[model samples]
Target: MNEKEALILKLIKEDPFISHFDLAAKADLPGDRVAGYISSLMKQGKIVGRAYVLPEQRQVLCVGGANIDRKIWSKGVLELGTSNPAESSKSCGGVARNIAENLGRLGSGVSVLTAVGEDHEGHWLMEYTRAFADVAPSEILKGHSTGTYTAVLDQEGEMTVALAEMSLYDSITPEFIDRKWSYFASSDFIMLDTNFPADVLNRIIERCRKENIQLCITPVSSPKAKKLPHDLLGVTWLIANKDEAEAISGIKIETEGDFFRAAETIIHKGVEKVVISRGDKGLIYFTEKGEAGVLIPPAISIIDVTGAGDSLVAGIIYAHLNRIQTEDACKIGMACSILTLQSIETVNPILNNQQLLETFKQNFK
Candidate 1:
């Protein structure tokens, strides 16, 4: 075998499910070149077995909330404590659900582990979410009420006020996650949002640690963000909004310096990587190994800011799983967020790997 082919084979043997993107990164070669080498190896019968056959099929387990989102768009200027002419719509949403759907749309195999109520909202959520993800009926609760988020948007499509009835997530107890330990242990990556109960989150973190599975976390909200442990042991990636980051790091973010410091505080707590999303201003990220930078997104018209953060998390996870470089991964994340920002829907229906790559090429190149 050629030297490049031999090296690819060694990497495949080490991580049978590693993506060509990851292999290319490790070999410091262009992705297309690596793909050519892999194809040659496969044609020569040097690559075999199910695991090495389809790297894109590697599964990601998303454990957290699944709920219905009710959005109201005002037709005019807002008034306090009074009704106004507005457009109302309901869609399937929740931090974890959005991330999973984005990943699935981007050609990743994704499974959702969350609970929804027996009501119509829950049923609708389950059916809609299943379009992009594998969510077993048993994983959804039968008796409880499905979680719901109600938001009022301004004329600019920015959320002005929001309310959530997410108590149903309590049904996803530690015992429930414990029952699914085997599945968690087998996944290529585990992603979680803070909508889960603190104890349940702790259990999943501990289990991922023991199994050596990569764990990615999003705080979901400033309040629920506090559910994260003070010491973020076992967390491979921690992605949060500015508010959520401040809450977890106990550092107020007012300037670029403060943003880096906040990320540093979280990294010191044992998180391998920290990404703090600063809306409009862009994102600042830091790694435990001292890699840090700010990614400024290309300017784009904003249709709706909802679900942008979820898309960012999904993008980061997608790029990271493919072993893309950290800076480029953040750029991909920015691209995803920009796509969502241009859509009225919480998760843009047209989002996919091809679209993301096109956006990256158009903006970054």
Candidate 2:
């Protein structure tokens, strides 16, 4: 193929549904010239007709930690300083991985960008994340210990304390992101967790801004959340739990007024929208355009709250990609969290688009 034809093919591979106009713009060619090239390629059997084209799947790239989670569920009231009877289990869990899995289950084209060690745990995590998303071979690093998080859950399934060993993620440097930059450029949206190094996050933020890509973030936890940049310019969405919002914004969330103020503080930092997950009380949100409200989720029996926040992020992204209204998007996110809370696993395996819609109708309608 000629140079122009090769360039057109590359662009098409990156985005199968890219319009002729967009292709012309990117290729720096006249519209007629681009059309001629496409027609030529079609005649050569290098490009298929749109009639055979599948619906474009909106791709979301998630960049953050991918680790093994160890949960210790106490059978009864436990002492903090001493041993207690507990049921222990291990599963693949990380803020980014969980979000990717949830989005994959919801039928979004998802990809994960993170690092894992060369150990058994890393191999396991790589395979597990690949089950739900497309993971590039270079995304998983070598010669480091795979990150791990250990959580102690109370009898009510609420987390009491958790410890994370995720230094391996430090290897996800700006250079690493640059190596996989095409994924970011082609994605419909990008989700980041605060587990990333600050410099790496900043680099990604800058790139997304330059490309006009929508960027979303999940502040994994309070302490780690503090690692986020002070200025969140170009951030399309900031999804955080109450503690994470409080930590990042330094606003104590003791009342309804405080919740609004916290969301406002984040919006002032240049985040287009801020969503605060308030566990059982539901969600409170605010937008840069002065729209704000609370979404109270329907009550449900709790099993384990392990990955509720991650699932909530996935739900909102899913809704946004599908062009669901903002208010209804929050409702879908609430339903996702409710479904996750009822499952013992980190991500509810049975959760799908149909089930999420049914839950939303049953509760919100």
Candidate 1 — what's its lDDT? 0.86
Q: How well is each residue in 1-365 modelled by candidate 2, as lDDT tens digits?
A: 68998898889888888888889999999999998888766544355556224223338989888899999999999787898899999999989989999999998899888888889998898887787898872355667898999999999998999999999887677887775675676578999998888898889888888768899989888888988888888999999988999998999999988999999999989999899988889888899998889988877899999999899999999998889877888889988888899999999999998999998899999
Candidate 1 collision pairs: none
Q: In model 2, what lDDT does residue 284 have?
A: 89
- Cα deviation of 74, candidate 1, in Å: 0.8
- Number of clashes recorded per candidate: 0, 0
Question: Which segments of candidate 1 are over 4 A away from where they belong?
Answer: 1-58
In model 2, the runs with Cα more than 4 Å from the true position are 1-58
Residue lDDT tens for model 1, 121-209 = 87788888888988862365677888999999999898999999998787677888765664565478989999988988888888788
- Model 1 residue 289 lDDT? 90
